[model samples]
Target chain A: MSSLSRTTFASLIFGFSFLYLPLIFTAIFAFSDAELAGVWTHFSLKWFKAILNDEDLLIATFTSIRIAGISATVSIILGTLAAAATMNTPRGKYDGYNFLKRIILLPIMIPEIITGFSILMLFMVIESMFGWPKERGILVVAAGHSVASVAYVYATVSSSLASLDQSMGESAINLGAKPIHVFFHITVPLSWRAIVSGWFLAFILSFDDLVIASFLTGPGTSTLPIVIFSNIRVGVTPTINAFVTVFVVITIILASIVYFRTLCLKGRRKGRSATR
Target chain B: MSKKVVGFFLFITLLIVILQWKVKDDYSGEVVNVYGWYGIIPREIFNDFEKETGIKVRYDFYDNNEMLEAKLLSTNNGYDIVFPSFIPYASRQLLMGIYSKLNRKLIPNIKNIDGIITSKFGANGGDVQFLVPLFWGTIGIAYNKKVVSQLLPGETIDSYDVLFDLSKISKLFPYGVSFPEEYIDILPQTRKFLQLKHGGESVTDFQECFRFLEKVRPYITKFSSTTMISDLLSGDVCIAIGASDNAYRAMRSSKAVDKDIQYTLPKKTGILWIDCLGVPKKAPNKRNAYLLINYLLSPEVAAKITNHSGILVNLPAALPLINAEIVTKKDICQSDPEVLEGLTMGCARAENTRELIKAWSQYKTNTHHTSINKEASK
Candidate 1:
């Protein structure tokens, strides 16, 4: 039994090391002085300085942030509403609820490149008909990103809704509360954490997207992932390593804050229960 | 919390509207949208162009020719200037009626362009009105001399057999060969190498190219478009068939890290490629596009582009301004016309391209399975 346990432990370590070793190497190389990527001659911070001064990269980063924020927000609102609609409607009352759910989740099923190209075609048709969107710019990119993100948000929020007690909303409605009020006061509050998590997930998906972003990107609207991808294609420069490092740092900070806040909330809930 | 979230959403909506308005206004300015290969042009040139012409240059990049073609065909691509390789795609684009004629009157600097460039394009149905030559280079074998020297003492590295003669070189360094992943770049070289070996066939022969490609498929450890230079520098692959400019750049970069790498033009034949700048049809900023082109053509700007890109430029006036060391490097500066002796320039192969690409794909798939089987047996 001891031997089996030790072997399993060793395999676990091997698996995780295989997964994270590249990321560790990337972080280490971000500070390496070498240009051609093999041996570290000396430690340096010049790559970070180079990243800060790269106007195009900075602009791309800003564009990505803007698109991710807007797309995530749009996903949250639309996903929450869709989840509410499905949860409220009776199976027989809405004859096509399952079909609607599948349609809503279709973006997740379809390959991203196909979705990107299709969205591009859709936007082009809409532009031809209405002449509203003068060009394929940020709004179009945001819409393209939101298409993929909505499914993610919907999946998370709907799962949370499915797990919730059915009688809560019913009891609220029976206690002389309006249906809309019950939805706002009960359904939303209970599912708020899931919605927030879904929003963050959508944000990351839109942020990290390269294929869809490439198709939807137009003049002056190149995103971070697209720029990094093209630059890395030629060669892996130290500046790209620095960019990845910064991205990793940001992700870590965000994750830590969320983790600590959740811990605190849980602790507070425990204390309230103890008092009761 | 809900109210705060709503307010934040409203604020973001307002910000997006403002940004969109600004983007629309940017088009009215003297902005030239230049699409070209990534890392080909230095950023300083764009800054200098903006300073001189007051035309803001927004540069975008693509790795392959197909992407550029797709962009040109798409509605409202908004690119004013596109730098596509002169052969095949440019000519194909011309046939498609997607490109606009250059206003030679606006570009008085056209006179500064070398006659060799203009005449070559003119002979090949590339009118000066349609394309302005940007940079030109050749595709050849890039090798590590230290490794190749031990394999064959006193033998010159000028021939493609340094890569193709697998039994001789592969035993010396197993899996020491790498070819390009792109069919377009590798196919031309394959045709030329096989022609040199098998003695003169049509440049468009699918069976011949595939024969050589399949013969070499097992010897090559990887088909790399992106990581070829790195592999060569690391002494992983002794020989790589790549562009002269890329090979030269890798050699220069390796010097900084104390790695020995060198590039050699094939002794008998090589594929010559020239990338040209042109304005696409219905370009919103044609006037600024012309200004930017003429600016790029100017001797000083052209010299800087040549120096930084490590590729030869066609502006005769820029020649005097180019660094003496750079001009002497045969790979970058093949100014003499005599050097064009056995070089085959890529032309519009629209007829054979589809079939050749298909055959190559099938060959590659077969080779991939064989390689997998060999690995499994090992």
Candidate 2:
């Protein structure tokens, strides 16, 4: 191989290993039989079995998943609409539109601790005034996560939407397609990849969030990260590693399926183009 | 594709609806929400409480006292019960009126609390009407026997001298000597060691502690509280000034790794740390909170907690029921009245806390090595 190709190959290996070595070690140690989490002993599935009986961990994991799902979906919907509204507006037509765009990005720019504290204050004010959300719980946590995640989704979707040929939607509208149909069929279809990536980004953000969730969490609303963090002072059990390994395996399986599905879709598109 | 996306979203909505339904189901019965340190209470105890009283226990956890204090200080925090450390947090929060007065009539089992722990907490301005001193531990020296013996042969690892003494700590510097992260944990012991007046509110008392800490700062390898247990077990630190429960855990785990780990309260000065169980002023289910507290104070449950977690529950009756290994461990479950009597509870004064923190940070970041260099010049 040429030196350029050799350098490229070396960098690729370096990058991938750097990203994955810690995960690989965590996976390996999950199966160790030792009492100490870091120690390596003979391979055992006891920790996995231990997870089966840990009701609190299971509940926390379920709560985390539910919050992530709700937040990701809500953020994606709100974000896509925000992106469309902001991007479709004529430049300098509305001064408030520019301010609105900046306001939407504020959650991303500001520190999370400040955001968490302010959201907590907001909840307390709302509780005192309206007394509707009488107690903070899953709904409050999900709402906080959604507020934080919407900025990320907006950033991802708008950048992809900006690169799109606007003329395609305009032409479709001219060809007897209504504006709603044009948006759904043309704009959304073109930008769905960015939307999917954005959803994943939002999902991960909500899933691993500790600061905001801690502030908003009430009785029986502890998320997985909160539960794991609370266990850190007392060293975390190997069951957590076992749980992570299970999570990693599931994520890998889902990713490969998505990867193969996209590959197949690309192959089908190429064949259709060649036939045409 | 739109249909698939719609289907996925519908599935997520359905899952959320089901989860919300499940969460709502919990409130149908009498419920008490408890927030405390993680891994301290065994799950079996909660289950038993529920079975006996038919009041479900919804337990949450915070790793540190600051988080608990923040939640408590907030209006309508919705926690029926919370465990805050006695000194500084519980005492400070008590003064803030975040905790409600306990209905002693509801909790008849309050008599079971060990007197020694109670008096120590009371002396430190902890009030039984507001806070129940349920869990207690000591701050002391945890050292790896093999490493320490090799480094300083024939040296007894009992006192804070293993940590604060310049000559002794300098010897253990290469093997690693870690101090406590919190100023409250080490400063009181430092005061006791230096024979400074405990009640002296002067900034000079803090200055004296820092002056001593500054001399030995370079020899100290790291300042951490949470990582002490693992650091000892992994041989990362041969000596650490930390909580007794963490040291006990390290000692227990060390046996498996073929390493001897020991914890000792200094003969001259041992600091007692207490976690107070209190009901929030705005608790939603105060009645159920009382029931849960009464249940936990029972000997069987309290013993189970100590046996499982190695944290000493402040119930003297539970001592006999605890594991023989833990009950026998002098440094951990201190049965001796003399040792318990000598223990000083450390509390940071509210007005001088900022000054103490400033001095602590200054000592932590001071890297000039002025004392050592001056000695070398001499």
Candidate 3:
């Protein structure tokens, strides 16, 4: 066997074990009624019952879904349009394009606490000035996440756009089809996979966020991860483990589909692919 | 193959979505929600109270008081019975007003309170009620005797001074001691020591605590809240200092397994903390809360909790009923020694706490590098 294939196989085994071993422990502990994690004398589903009935956690979960959905939609719209514009340009031609990309990435790159603090201060100042208080509710949190998520979506869509045969659009144009028509029919339909995956990817990033959400979230509007974090600060109970197992399973499945689909798409495209 | 896989994925996705959406919290009646810390308190006490008075008790716990305090400070927190650290309760005015109007007639055991604690909560010139002091304890170090014996010079280590004194113990804890990175416990110790050495004031903010924590920074192997107690018992650590109750836990757990564990009472105790119960001003089940407080004050319930939790309760009746075996064994760290040793008295003195807090913050800042379990100390 080639060294490349062997190295790849070894790393895959190591990485999967590293990630899922603890998750498996969490899953195991979720079935038990032991007060402490160490000695497990009994197995019970009581914790799952508590988690399912928890009002605050349920509210936080709903809040996360709503916020994630809104953020993803807004981010993908801006990201796809930006990708559509940027993909055709030769890499070095636009002098300030790199700077624009950096600006878009500032939310994701800087320390989250710093970003959170700055936005909170900015919100405070705006409220004081306008007397509008501009409501730092779920809407503001969604906007904050969208700003960060745009970079991911932009990266995903632009690469997918670049993979398209440039001649296909030109050929359609040559046949007297309008440019907008060519884009809507030919380009969008073909790239829906990337766009949909990017949207889901953005959704996960936004949903899982805690630090930014904690600061930006107004009274009674925290997301699920924030609630989970608050609960964890007290203690780790099997109930929380149950809730988290569900999250783990859901995310793993979503991530697996996203991963394999990209692999298949890239296999077909050949030149550029997500490294996974 | 692909169609079936895709169909299965869609089915699971829809199930999760529906499950998450369908799980909603509907509140009807007869329950007073509580947020507190987990300890030796039994559910039977709460159940008995519920049976006598028809108010159901739903309890939740925070690892430390800060998280609870933060939640209480939020506008919409609906907790009716909030158990906060005595110092934390002292730091805020949120509960003071609610306490001022408690009907003493309903709680016949109110007379059983030790005079000192009663004075702490009782009315002044007017009816200014503070929290009913339920449990009180001193901060000290709890250690595994086996590990600490190894640290002793010629097997003789016995004191807190043996901990930080480099001359007597050159490399006893090369990888520092295990203590939580918290403002309440560590910051105060740093403040007291730094003041003794450098004569600085107290601190209250994160920046100040950063400086405070930095002084003892190198001595800290790792700062953890709840982990330090179990780790010390399991022999992963030589010694850890914070609350005596956790030390009592280590001692009791060892006794259960027939191992020697020692929790040393320091020459000068860092802080005296009290955990108290109070009903919110807007408690839906105020009668139930009153009945529960009365029930907790009962001799049997109080003795069981104080014995199991290793915290000293204020009830005079409860004190006599506690198992003499535990107290005599020093399985519990006593506050009388703490008072005799002159614990900094940080829990009281509300007017002066801000400055103390400021100094405490500075001390924590000093030990910031080793800070992780900031809430653990509380």
How much is B193 displaced in model 1, in angstroms?
Answer: 5.1
DockQ of 1: 0.41
TM-score of each predicted structure versus truth? 0.90, 0.94, 0.62
Order of the predicted models by lDDT, top scorer first: 2, 1, 3
Which runs in model 2 stand beyond 4 Å of their true positions?
A1-4, A90-99, A171-178, A271-276, B367-378
lDDT of 2 by residue, B1-378 (tens): 777656655775786687678768866878899998888898888998888888888888788988888888888888999989888788888888888899989999998985888988888788988889999999988898898999889988777767776777888999888989888898888888999875785766666667677788888888999888878877788999999999888887786677899888886688899988999989999999998999889999889999989999999898889998887788877768888888877755798777667667666777453333333446
* lDDT winner, 1 or 2: 2
Off by over 4 Å in 3: A2-105, A118-147, A162-188, A216-276, B1-115, B118-135, B150-176, B183-220, B248-270, B275-344, B347-378
Top model number, TM-score: 2
Error of model 3, residue B234, in angstroms: 4.2
Best by DockQ: 2
Candidate 3 lDDT over B1-378, as tens digits, reads 334434534654664455335422213356666666554465566777778777767654455565566555543345567777665453364435534345677777766666555454442111224467777766776766665566664654334565556543345465347775554665555445444432233234333445444544556565665665556544566677767776666666555334576776555535666677776664556666666777788888888887766767767677678888557755253536334344554434355456545544444455443332344355
* DockQ comparison, 1 vs 3, better candidate: 1
Task: List the DockQ of the predictions in order.
Answer: 0.41, 0.58, 0.08
Model 1 chain B is weakest, by summed lDDT over 10 consecutive residues, at B368-377
Better of 2 and 3 by lDDT: 2
